[model samples]
Target: MAIIYPLQPRLSSTSTKIVIGLIWALAFSLAFPQCYYSVTQHYPPRTICMVNWPDDYGGKHHLTYQIAMIVLIYLLPLLVMLITYSLIGQTLWGSEIPGEASDHYQNQIQAKRKVVKMMIVVVMTFALCWLPYHIYFILGSFNKEIYMQTYIQQVYLAIFWLAMSSTMYNPIIYCCLNQRFRSGFRHAFSWFPFIKVSEEDKMELQHTQTFRMTRSYRTENTKSTVVRHNSTQHDDHTTVKLMKS
Candidate 1:
């Protein structure tokens, strides 16, 4: 949405909180029904409460939940990212920013390209990491015998590792690929003896805050101007009505 309307006023903190709260509530409710559906087994050294299957109808509940979640949580978000990033890529590459100076335009283009590239990498990582995990469960749900195979635990372990790696890579990708994020990261660890934060890093951090403040100021000014214009028109209309009477 920000990419679609960059000039529009951003959501306030209250609005952001409300959105976050609503999403959490909705997600919790969706997963609530199957949360308690599980089976427990006791191994020699450990007790495994095999939730999401074995306790209830695995095909009826677990498989359905798996498919639903795969669509809702994984595929839907991936599709959104792909689409939004594609549009953003087109927007960035399609034309020069109107009225921007040549050098500044090129700089802006380069920065935006880095961001888009980062997003694509992030999306690809997410898909690769989670796709197998989803597929594994779907397959196991359909054929329970697969879970009994000797290599099943190993495959599951590998898939779990890969899926978790997705969560850990985004920061690394941002730090490695983008100068701005790297700069901020360096500044964050500047207190450590081994970490060095340069003047440029400080500027990079400040630049983001400055840009946000400037954008907010412009939005407020625009709103105020509109309000004043409306007030002036109303005053003129009142004056005209009195004169006519």
Candidate 2:
């Protein structure tokens, strides 16, 4: 998604959303299997040591701690992203109503709002899916025995996978579902090295440049005129003084 953002300006909100969703999905897919394996392989009988840790505790304790750490690391960033996106979405979508401002500004605001909201939803979905795993881990960390219980472990695994599945689902729901995003993504991928810049946009940019140049020129000209006028007055005064002498 980050890669997609810089590659094309015309990329649709849907495409961005899909890209983001897919990223999360891929991460979850890859991580969830590992998580499952870790739980199943290490938690039972509890005699495996894939990574080395301090020998303060037995293998089971080490595995439990490692799993807890993994959950915390993944969960924190996801939570932060979700919170940030939610705030951004609210700012974008809820800032101003249609009739509250002029048509031009209002439309601009609304469009921005829509984009923000879509992004927020995309991020929010990822956060929602991942949150359960983190919560479970946090609780489990304090009470390893409770976490090791068959029912508790089963419930955590179920929720964990469900959250991970969200990563794949996000791309489909946000990107594939929206027509604009689909078109944007297609267009972006179609051209190899070429960029698509609209004629109207070009003209507008040119006009803005011309206006700034004109203003600068006028300002300089006005300053020159004042300087010339001052010189002329000084010359006239000198001439009158010389005639009087």
Candidate 3:
């Protein structure tokens, strides 16, 4: 007989990534005040600001650009982590249709493929979005002329903030795109007071139950076989005694 495997609950890698990403975010936020102070107070007005005034400007505006850069550098990667995690969970845990085992299995496989494709797209997008800023900054370190342009500074700051906002948007995506994560998060607080058994624990319990059932069945079968053998031997002995009499 073909044994049907029971549906197993999928584990969330998303939770782990979310925790790490949040830690990074908090650290960045905590460091921001000191960074702002150093830029506004300690650095020379020209060093912190756009150097070119009028046509090319640098000063406080430049400082804002730097702050935006710091935030974006931290935020975009965290966002990617979150989005990837959610996608992974969704691909693993989505419901299967009943009465169509093959179709359901095929759907799951397709979902996994789609997740891989999405991951590649996300990685490329991150690279494209952040690479320019990193290159510009590296070049700017050598050439002061880059910092002298007010319009360039504005454009850089805009891109930086746009990238940084990706981090904040992950939570929104989690709520919107992945139903499993959304439901899990929604009910998480409800289980706060109680000790919850993990999915592993539940699986262990199921295996234990199955083992006990198999053991009981085997024992019963063995007892029945022994009883039948004894009865047959007794009947044979009686027939031989009657024939001899």
Q: Against the true structure, what is each candidate's TM-score? A: 0.84, 0.40, 0.38
Query: What are the per-model numbers of colliding residue pairs?
Result: 0, 2, 8
- lDDT scores in order: 0.85, 0.63, 0.59
Evaluated against the true structure, the overall lDDT of model 1 is 0.85
Deviation from native of the Cα of residue 229 in model 2, angstroms: 30
Which tens-of-lDDT digit does each residue in 20-68 have in candidate 1? 9999998997777666665578898988766655545447677787889
Q: In model 1, which residue pairs have backbone atoms overlapping below 3 Å?
A: none
Q: Point to the candidate with the largest lDDT.
A: 1
- Candidate that beats the other on lDDT, 1 or 3, i.e. the better one: 1
Give the Cα error of residue 92 in candidate 2, in Å. 6.9
lDDT of 3 by residue, 132-187 (tens): 66666556645668767869878788767766654455455454544344455545
lDDT of 1 at 85: 84
Q: Write the per-residue lDDT of candidate 2 for residues 88-192, one digit (tens) a residue.
A: 666656665446467867656765666775676777677778777666755654555775576975797799787778778665655544444544444556575
- TM for candidate 3 is 0.38
Q: Which number leads on TM-score?
A: 1
Q: Which stretches of candidate 1 lie over 4 Å from their true place?
A: 7-15, 29-34, 52-60, 98-101
> How much is the lDDT of residue 185 in candidate 1?
88
Candidate 2 stretches with Cα past 4 Å from truth are 1-72, 79-109, 176-179, 182-245
